[model samples]
Target: MYSNLDRPPLNVTELRRGLDPFFSQLDVVAETGSTNADLLARAADAEADRSVLVAEFQTSGRGRHQRTWVSPAQAQVALSVLVRLPGIAPADLGWLPLLTGVAVADAVRSVAKVPAELKWPNDVLVEGRKLCGILAEVGTTGKNPTVVVGIGLNVSLTEDELPVPEATSLVLAGAEVSDRTTLVRSLLRDFASRFTAWESAGWATSELADVYRERCATIGAQVRAELPGGDRIEGTATDVDANGRLIIDGRAVSAGDVTHLRPLE
Candidate 1:
């Protein structure tokens, strides 16, 4: 049996002391149903901008398309961040999740020392195995709508504990997993920096697209994208467009479930 003791609790106090000034609010709970949901509810408040929520265990964590994400207690980094993006246009908002993917991949590569690449539309992969999933939801709470970005990163889950066979963890990828505090800090800081820069540039995509392209593994690969309405498209992915849509076979896909047909060589 895998004891929960092996995965210790996060140091909320230390995290707050380190991360408070950047975010309007930073909270860490022992457990929650979903950090994204909680943060979305909080977005109704006036001071919800830059609010960050983290959970040690999620009872009802969800991913894109309502897919449930389950993991052992204290085995993953389940977190959500809310940012008021009144300045950014709705069309440009698609970049938020992709930006998050780049930040997460960078964090994993720097902290875990693993080569983390990104699957289009925001799945972090290590050696072709999914290590994290990102979900960004829009909340029309105040005069300016808010965007809550949720990230779930596997830190120490064993093979049997994975939600899917294609999923992996830092430990399984031969990375250290004891100090989740550091990983959390790195992820938050990196995201904040990139998001701030992107917003400062009036939601421009030049720099963000460049960074996303460099870290994205789906580009330059054969892909099968299952679009909405039960339609699918198969082609070679060439680029991520200026608006953050996956460009597959000359088609700019705004939304779809992309699957790589072959491994990254």
Candidate 2:
């Protein structure tokens, strides 16, 4: 499925070639309108099982809360993967983003040589600054559940290119910002390996739970979750449930915007 080779140059070709042993199908786009958009459109026509879309630049990228994600051309990794989950209940869909966040934390740790942590539902943080953003979208099309996991990572962006004040890149965090292709390749490989395990044992397996909790930045800390209903719940972050819900005090928070109350030492 190496059809988009004519676009531009990327170092991810080597990474894709290495990943050939794991995935049966792969697709890389030099520049796309948006990887998520392209995959969603294709999912409407084809099964798109285990297919990946990697874009060098996205003209219109989106994140959680439907916020726009900004990136300079070739300055970040915008990737999406389409998978078909059969017999999975709609209620279990929330775990996909959490699974993705863990996968990303694993990948970044492997390549960046730094410890990464998960901020609630689907954000990756390094040194209390955002390093990655994950958005998982699920829909039932013709009785089959299609899940698109989109990941946007700040790889080599300069300070001026950052869209927000709190964003940080690998280079800024004292990690070398190598070729975007290599980083994306490593991410997909790590994610595929973890995803296979998660699918086999489910999210409750000790291995998955331990890893997520170890990398989580919110557990055992006081935090405030901003709910859509304009209600704020303040409590000590307890744990993350098997279904990827954030456990605050005794309540299972399925969705909200969380802000850690105290700084980590």
Best by lDDT: 1
Best by TM-score: 1
Q: In angstroms, what RMSD does candidate 1 have relative to the true structure?
A: 2.2
Per-residue lDDT tens digits for candidate 2, residues 102-166, read 88888787888767889988899988889899988874444467888899998777788788978
Instruction: List, residue by residue over 127-193, the lDDT tens digit for candidate 1.
Output: 8999999999987644477989999999999999999999999999998543789899989989989
Q: Write down the lDDT of every candidate, Cα atoms only.
A: 0.90, 0.78
Q: Which 10-residue span in candidate 1 carries the lowest summed lDDT?
A: 1-10
- Cα TM-score per model: 0.95, 0.89
Cα-based lDDT at residue 159, candidate 1: 98
- Output the worst ten-in-a-row residue range by lDDT, candidate 2: 1-10
Off by over 4 Å in 2: 1-9, 141-143, 202-207, 263-265
